[model samples]
Target: MFNKLFGKPKAKGKDAKANVKTVATALSSMERINENLDMLEKKEQILQRKIAAELAKATEYSKAKNKRAAINCLKKKKLFEAQAEQLAAYQLRLHDQMILLEGAKATTDTVDALRSSAVAMKAIQKQTKIDDVDRTMEDISEQQDNMKQIQDALTGPVGVASDFDEDELEAELEELEGTDLDEQLHESMSNVPYAQEPIMSSPEAAVPIPAPSKRTPPEKTPVHDRSEDEELAALQKEMAL
Candidate 1:
């Protein structure tokens, strides 16, 4: 029902990789450098073994008093030492090149990442405008107001209850309160004790108190004597005799 007042989102696709060197190229270069270093290291070890062998031959020749053979062996050992030093220098150069290549690769990756971010930001900014944002915010505020009105309507009192007069309710409540007050006053009056003031025996305030009244008992009814019945009984007894 409120569809026209709302907005949706848009999804952007990943851009194609630009003219950066591929990972395979960097890996191949690193592998080639490492292989060269490894080969140089192996040659260095072989030259070391050869130099040791030449020195040992020179020592044996010197012990046998052969001065010319000893001198030749010493010269050969010096040549082997020179070759080993050259191999070490080559390994060092290769190591330095590998470090520089790695640093270059990292710098390239960082630059590429920043460039891609800039491109994405530009695309999004082109798709969205300040005017569009303002309009969307206005729509959201209007929708919120509309929802609040709906909630108030839903929660409002209904039917006769809503139609009740406020003034009449207030008047009825006041009347009930007045009646309750009157009853409370009446109860307080009934519970209160009556106090009579003492009258001073003076001419100005001589009020007389009445004496208590004495009740008289009722007189008994008169009764005839039983002498007549006794005399009749005595006469009947003489007759029966």
Candidate 2:
């Protein structure tokens, strides 16, 4: 995504390896020089001991009255001092050379480190960009939202209509319930026996009932009216009793 933002990396691996190799070589040379300096120091110490021994021999010779032997010993001591001075100069030159090489090695190593760091920074810049990161985050958020919607759709209740009216359904259910109750009441009434009105035994009732007369059948009454009449008859029977 960020390829266009940073371009390609430069070629520097071979150069870095070469610099490291040079530094290694210089460090090795410095180590050898230090070793030589150490050897020179040891030689100087040995020469100092020899000079001391020669002086002691000269003192013994002079005490014994041997002037010629004492003079020869002093000449040998001078020769040893000259050699020690030359060795000291050589050791000093070696120290200088080692110091210079050590400094060069350190410089080379520092340059290599800086170069590696720059390369790493360049590579990182090539692989990332602020705009790309922002776009990617936005895309991730959008995908999450889409996934949530998809999951809701998949897991949502089936066969459940959202467009229907709950109030209407409730009202219809109430109507059905009322109808069922009415039917049950009707069934109960049908199951019960109707009560007969009792005949009164009062003086006002001395007139006998008339004989049956030819009359047309009564018109069919509504079921509710018939039920009401039966209930009224049952009440009347109770009152008569």
Candidate 3:
């Protein structure tokens, strides 16, 4: 039983170590493949140069009418071309292997990252539950409400201005306006002159004054005002004498 318990962990550890080594080996192999590909490319370039040189020699020999030398040069060019083709095929296989290894590495890395992320998520969930999240949200909402209430209290009006009677305010305003209007009307009335009766020469008796087109009520005229008008009329009559 103890062996069964302990053996599992040992096996798991060994498997993990093996996986790491495998990944490392894959990366090393990919590097080696790239190096080999580079070597193959260099070899192909040299072969192409040799082939070009051989073809040039073949052309020169053909121009000189030396068929045997030209044929030998062409044969050398064919060998070089075959070697170049073989190198190209090797490079192509290496490239395909590199692409597959890179793809596999990327997939393995992605899976490992996702597994780590899932583990992190599980640990976070263990520390913080759905119920805890709900409680936190409620606390936040409560704090927001309390802050809003505090702000409202701080920014509110200081007095009971809004609680005052609207009717009483309107009445006071009306009384003030009426008092101002009365003073203005009285000032205008005092400035107005009484209409005068005009006298003519010895042949003419007197010309009666024309009636005013506008008039105010007798009750509307102030009591002190009637006496002033009468006094003005009496002074005018005396001046005529």
For 52-133, candidate 1 gives per-residue lDDT tens digits of 9999999999999999999999999999999999999999999999888778666655666687688899999999999999
Better of 2 and 3 by TM-score: 3
Question: Model 3: how far is 47 from its true place, Å?
Answer: 1.8
- Report the lDDT tens digits of candidate 3 across residue range 64-140: 99999999999999999999999999999999998888787667656666766787899998999999999999999
- Candidate 3 off by > 4 Å: 1-19, 137-221, 224-241
**Residue 166 of model 2: what lDDT?**
83
What are the RMSDs of all candidates, in order? 20.2, 17.3, 11.2
What candidate 1 gets wrong by more than 4 Å, as runs, is: 1-32, 65-68, 167-241
lDDT per residue for candidate 2 within 1-241, as digits (tens), equals 1223222233357785676466557656866887899899999999999999999999999999999999999999999999899999999899889778767655665676788789899999999999999999999999999999999999865675766678998999999999999999989866665334344447864434454446643444444566664655444444443
TM-score of each: 0.58, 0.49, 0.55
Alpha-carbon local distance difference test for all models: 0.72, 0.75, 0.75
Give candidate 1's error at residue 59 in angstroms: 3.2
* Candidate 1 deviation (Cα RMSD): 20.2
| Candidate 2 ranges with C-alpha deviation above 4 Å | 1-12, 133-241
Considering every candidate listed, which one attains the maximal TM-score? 1
